[model samples]
Target: LIRGGRVELGDARDLPFTIKRSWARERLTPDVHPGGFVLGCNMTMHRDVAARIGYFDERFGAGGPLRSAEDTDYLVRAMLLGIAVEYVPDMTIFHHHGRRDRKAIEKLHRDYSLGNGGLCLKHVRH
Candidate 1:
């Protein structure tokens, strides 16, 4: 069985957060890894759980509207299918956290809206 989770990315000045496991869910407190859960870093090719889960929803892109909830959809579906999500704070990755200007923002909104709507149609219409 594969377990996965999500982590928050912080700025250089901010302390990176770690993933905390829910003690209540453990049958017996594990010694090897005290935390019953596992790691969840963003877009790491080697250890990313999505290789077992699947790829990003192509309906999402930088300038797309439906993009915001793509990750939420994946994580929710994984959980519903009984996949475990753990938070791993020790891992670090670099991401481009660029600020978009008004035009970029507008494009993203429109594209994401179209992409999300397209996803709904493709998945539900059949």
Candidate 2:
């Protein structure tokens, strides 16, 4: 939408990637590596994983004060705890966000940036 066109999101974020399981399942701190992100709207996980991570941080949710990055925060938390986190392409959901205009998309980007900044600060503080 910010790019000035019809935002057909079918392939907007999905990209071909190769992920290798880390032999040493240990981490010094939480980090969002490449291929570690998944859309919150389409996020799916085993009940155990959810229970382990203690669920999404509402503070980072789109409607919350942070305004975005709940999914990324969840993923990073899982990784830091040594819980498996992967991006599964086959498991998909059709999200019709209807952001067909530049103004809407630009706003979305701005909101996302704000949320991302908050997320970073949260992690750094911890």
Candidate 3:
């Protein structure tokens, strides 16, 4: 992790800031929707769902102006559109963000905030 601890995407029980105690540690069921907190690195969807939702907004992700929240925005769109989402806790993978230096770490946080703000604006305007 950038700040020194493990970035446990599976179970965020150790994290104090999350509203849900278990975070991504949910049983595989349609009843459990990940909402906008879904991580892009660990998600799968059917092609039809992709077709229905189009693609992640280019203006909100890593290569775009916002530099984050593309996954969040995509899932937000899915949820808003009434798409059926299921969280599969059994399927997992490691995410190596590679932000080692202090500058990179700070930039990550900055970009995250900026992206989040932009996402909020976009949704609020709609």
Candidate 4:
């Protein structure tokens, strides 16, 4: 797996959006360090790898009840199966959906938290 960049629509000074953008860029860029996990928006894999991994978990992501963490789940599984995941800084993508409001951002965080917990329970239990 290879991850890429995510540039937001607004100026860099835009509060939480700026912070989020910076965090993502720092993680995904090679200049800093290879990302700890793959983001769904910028993930890439060869057909063989995809076939071996069996693709993303349908139980997570936007339309699902969990609302996120599918990418993390997939990355975790791939790593467990001994796959190499890489972060590629040059492959950039622009993200326009930067939530400016506090409520929206909070909700996003909450959903991700819940999804992460669900992923852990589903995959980490003995």
Q: What would the per-residue lDDT of candidate 4 be over residues 3-103, giving only the tens digit for each residue?
A: 44444454443334422233433333223222224456767878888899996788888788888888777777776687767655555565556576788
Query: Please, what are the lDDT tens digits per residue for candidate 3 over residues 3-117?
Result: 0111233433322221222335432233443333446766677787888888789988779999988877777677677774555444545445554457776786787788888
lDDT, model 1, position 33: 26
State the local distance difference test value for candidate 1: 0.43
lDDT against the true structure, per candidate, is 0.43, 0.55, 0.58, 0.63
| TM-scores for the candidates | 0.41, 0.69, 0.69, 0.74
Tell me the tens digit of each residue's lDDT in model 2 across 3-70.
Answer: 00111245445322212222233222334341234556655667776787895788887679887777
Name the best candidate (by lDDT): 4
Residue 87 of model 2, lDDT score = 46
In model 1, what lDDT does residue 90 have?
A: 40
TM-score of 2: 0.69
Which of the two, 1 or 2, has more TM-score?
2
Clashes of each: 12, 0, 0, 0
Q: Report the poorest 10 consecutive residues by lDDT, candidate 4.
A: 27-36
Candidate number achieving the greatest TM-score relative to the actual structure: 4
Residue pairs in collision within model 2: none
Off by over 4 Å in 1: 1-52, 61-65, 100-126
